[model samples]
Target: MNALKGQTLEIVQEEFANKILQIQGVGGFILVRNNGQLLASKTDMTTDPQTLAAMMILSSQDCKTLQSTMGFSRYHYLMVTQEKIGKLY
Candidate 1:
């Protein structure tokens, strides 16, 4: 597949972030590599994007492990929710 870079990547990320922000409860949007590199973000949250990416990478691994142990199909998405901040998808 072709990869996006430079200004093109930024524009795409910005467009995607805009769409995500249109959701009723979304406060932020981030794009991260599987290795925890931050590609783009649109957030007002106090946490650093790099930190969130690293944490999310770890959490996703755990989720995959749980899925395997339970004999579940591969997941298409994951969401984590906190009482105060609501959900992250």
Candidate 2:
């Protein structure tokens, strides 16, 4: 299938983020490619979206590698929590 590009992709991204933001307690939304490119993000958080995307993508890869080495299946979700900060998913 042909992937969206240019203005078309931007519209879709905005629509998706708007829909998600409509849900209660939804503070942010971000979409990043496997290569660590920031496609779209709508966030009110202090952390930079680009930095967060890169870190999350890299950590996800590491987690997958660790899981495979342990002979485990893929995880449905990953969450990280810090007492001084907060939770990340």
Candidate 3:
């Protein structure tokens, strides 16, 4: 067996959060309280924590609802498809 070293899940998430959207293709909108309380956002070159946070709220709800319906034993964040996922340019 090989020994693994280095960052934890939190560390990885924080690192990604600290930087702008490093993923190749993704666009998002945050929906809070089942509505639009806040707007979370990220991009290749966008710096806005509040926006990203708002997205967290929306994502949370999506996960919760899915869990309730799907009866998931564990809960995690929700991640729908991003607009930039396709190549139609």
Candidate 4:
């Protein structure tokens, strides 16, 4: 079971890496579970994957709550753009 889990993780990481590579300006990305666990990530040295994952989870939850308050039935994606940084999900 442990070996299978490891293999699955490797496959996920590889697929994540491939997707990232296909993008043009993506410097890093994190694959996080719905429960805020870091499943797989490929990030630059300056980025902390765990911290980023936690923030993503929190932000997503907050968005959902806000959407509900605004009478929206669903929350689809969030994008934040800054001078030198951008996040899309």
Per-model TM values vs. the true structure:
0.70, 0.79, 0.36, 0.67
Please identify model 2 stretches exceeding 4 Å from their true place: 1-7, 83-85
Best candidate according to TM-score:
2
* Candidate 3 local Cα displacement, residue 64, angstroms: 0.4
For candidate 1, give the lDDT of residue 47: 74
| Per-structure clash totals for the candidates | 0, 0, 2, 0
lDDT, candidate 3, 1-89, per-residue tens: 12236766555544554453454544532223445443233334243545556566666677787889999866644444546543211
Model 2's TM-score against the true structure: 0.79
For model 4, name the residue pairs that clash.
none
**Model 1, C-alpha of 55: deviation from truth (Å):** 0.6
Query: Per-residue CA lDDT of candidate 4, range 1-89, in tens?
Result: 13254577567668767887679977767788889988777766455778878888998899888888898777667776545454545
The TM-score, computed over Cα atoms with residue i paired to residue i, of candidate 1 is: 0.70
lDDT of 4 at 20: 77
Candidate 1 achieves a global lDDT of 0.79
Write the candidate numbers in order of decreasing lDDT. 2, 1, 4, 3
Instruction: For candidate 1, write residues 65-86 as lDDT tens digits.
Output: 9899998888888888868656
